[model samples]
Target: MAQKNYSGVNISVDEEGYMTDSSQWTKEIAKEMAKEEGLNLTEEHIKLLEFIREKVLSGSALTIRAIGKSGFTDIKGFYQLFPGAPLKKATKYAGVSKPSTCV
Candidate 1:
C-alpha cells in the first residue's frame, strides 16, 4: 500500500493506485483522480461512480454487463465514460478494488 494526497487528504492506496480504504473517499478525491485521468467528472459520472461503489460495498461482482444492466449507463456508454479500460478506471475512481474481471 501507498499513501497519496488527494483533496489535501492522504489516502491509502494499493500499488495500482486503487484506494485501500473506501471510507476515506470523498467526491473531491474522485474528481482529482478523474482529472488525473484527463476527465472532468460530471454529475452523470458521479452518479455512476456512486453506483459502482454501492455494488462493490454490497459484495456484488462488478462487470461491464452488470453495469449495463444497472440503468446507470449501458456498456457502450460505460466504455465512453471511462474510455480505454472502463471497469478498471471506474472501480478506481469509485474508490473500490479493481474488479476481478479486469486485467
Candidate 2:
C-alpha cells in the first residue's frame, strides 16, 4: 500500500493506486485522482463515479456492459470519458477497489 495526499487528506492506496478504503473517499479526492489520470471531472463524471461507488458498495459486480446500461452513457461514451482502461480508471476515481472484471 502507498499513501497519496489529495486535497490535504492522506489516502491509502494499493500499488495500482486504487483506494484501500472507500470510506476515505471524497469528491475532492476523486477530482485530484482524475486530474492525475489526465481527466477533468465534469458533473457527468461525478455522477458516474457516484453510481459506480454505490454499485460496488452494494456488492454488485461492475462491468462495462452494466455501465453501458446505466443510462449515464453508452459503452463508447464510457470509453471516451475515461479513455484507455475505462473500468480501471473509473474505479480508481470512484475510490473503490479495482473490479475483478478488469484484467
Candidate 3:
C-alpha cells in the first residue's frame, strides 16, 4: 500500500492508486484524482462519480455496461467522459477500491 495526502487527509491506496478505504473519500479527493488524469470534471462527471460510489456502497458490481445505464451516459459517452478503461478510471476517481472485475 501507498499513502498519499490529499487536501490534508492522508489515505492509503494500492499500487495502482486506488483508495483502500472508501470512508476516507471526499469530493475534493475525487476532483484531485480526476485533475491528475487531465480531466476537467463537470457536473455530469460528478454525478457519474456519485452514481458509481453509490453502486459500490450498495454492494453492486461496477461494470461498463452497468455504468452506461446509469442515466448519466451510454457506453460511448462514458468512454468520451472517462476516456480509456472507464470503470477503472472512474472507480479510482470516485475513491472506490479497484473492482474485482478489473485486471
Candidate 4:
C-alpha cells in the first residue's frame, strides 16, 4: 500500500510503506470521504466526525470508545463520517503524521 509523508504540511505519498501526514481529520474531508464511501452526507455524519476529531486532536487518539458519548445514537454515524478511513492516513492527509494506509 502507498503511504503519505508527514514531514510537511502537504499531502504526499512516500517512496516506502510509510505515511508522514499530520492528522487533522477535519469535518470537511471526512464528509467528502463519507460521500465516496456510499454514505449520505448528513448533518449527523458531519457532526459526528467533527466531534470525533475535536476530541481526538485535543488529546489522545480517539478509539471508538471516545465517540460513544457524542450524539450519534449509533456507530453508523461514525462510519458515515470516518468509515474506517484510517485515522493515521486521514491524519497524514491532514498533514499531521506519516500514514501507514490510504484513506
Candidate 5:
C-alpha cells in the first residue's frame, strides 16, 4: 500500500496508485488526481467519472469499448478527455481500482 496526499488528506492507495478504500475518495481528491495528470475536471469529465463509478458499484466491468458504446464519448473523444491510457487514468481518478484489462 502507498499513500497520496490530496488536499491535505492522506489517502491510502495501491501499488498502481488506485485508492484502496473508495470511502476515502472525495471530489477534492479527484480534482487533485486530475491536476497531477495535467487535467482540469470539466463537467463532461465529472459525468464520465460518475458513470464509471456507478457502473463499477453495480458490478459491471469496464473497458474502452464498453465506455465508448455507452454514449458518453467515443474512443477518440475519451482519449482526448483522458490522454494516454484513458481507462487507466479515468478509473484511477474515479477512485476505483485499475481495470482488469489494463496492464
Candidate 6:
C-alpha cells in the first residue's frame, strides 16, 4: 500500500490495495461508500459529514456517538461512514477527542 495525495487530501492504503485521495472523496462518494457499508444516508450521514468537515477545518477529530448525539439519531448509519475505523482512534484522527472524553 502507498500513500496518495489527491487535491491536497492525504490518504494511505494498508493492504496491497490502492489508495485514493480524500480530496477526491465527495459527499456522493461517501454516500455510496456508506451504502456499501450497509448505511442509509439519512440526516445522520449529513450530520457526520458536517462534524467531519468541521473537525477537518478546525484540525480536530469527530466521533460516531458524539456526532450522533450532536443531532443525528442513527448510530448504525454513523458507523457505516467508517466501517473499518477503530473505535478508540476514530476521534483521534479528527482530533475531536479531548482529554475529558478519554477519561
RMSD of each: 1.6, 1.4, 1.6, 6.9, 1.8, 6.6
- Root-mean-square deviation of Cα positions for candidate 5 versus the true structure, in angstroms: 1.8
Put down candidate 3 lDDT per residue, 2-85, tens digits, no spaces: 999887889999999999999898888888888887988888988999999999989987888998888889999999998888
Per model, how many backbone clashes are there? Answer: 0, 0, 0, 19, 0, 5
Report the C-alpha lDDT of model 5 over 1-103, residue by residue, as the tens digit.
7888999999999988899898787788998999987899988998898889988877788888888987889989999999888999999999998888554
Candidate 5 runs further than 4 Å off: none
Model 1 per-residue lDDT tens digits across residues 46-102: 999999999999998888999999998999999998899999998999999999854
Model 4: residues >4 Å from true position, as ranges? 1-27, 75-103
Off by over 4 Å in 2: none
All models: lDDT?
0.92, 0.94, 0.88, 0.45, 0.88, 0.46
Evaluate residue 39 in candidate 6 and report its C-alpha lDDT on the 0 to 100 scale.
Answer: 56
Candidate 1 contains a number of clashing pairs equal to 0
Predicted structure with the largest TM-score when compared to the true one:
2
Worst 10 residues of 5 by lDDT: 94-103
Candidate 6 local lDDT, residue 34 = 47
Off-target runs (Cα >4 Å) in candidate 1 are none
Clashing pairs in 3: none
**Candidate 6: pairs in clash:** 60-94, 60-95, 61-94, 61-95, 61-96
Residues 1-103 of candidate 6: C-alpha lDDT, one tens digit per residue: 5664433545563332222333444555444434544655555445556566575456544455655675544666546554665333232222233213343
TM-score of each: 0.94, 0.95, 0.91, 0.46, 0.89, 0.44
Per-residue lDDT of 1-103 in model 2, one digit per residue for the tens? 7999999999999999999999999999999998987789999999999999999999999999999999999999999999999999999999999999644
- Rank all candidate structures by their lDDT, best first, as comma-separated numbers: 2, 1, 3, 5, 6, 4
Q: Could you tell which candidate, 4 or 5, scores higher by lDDT?
A: 5
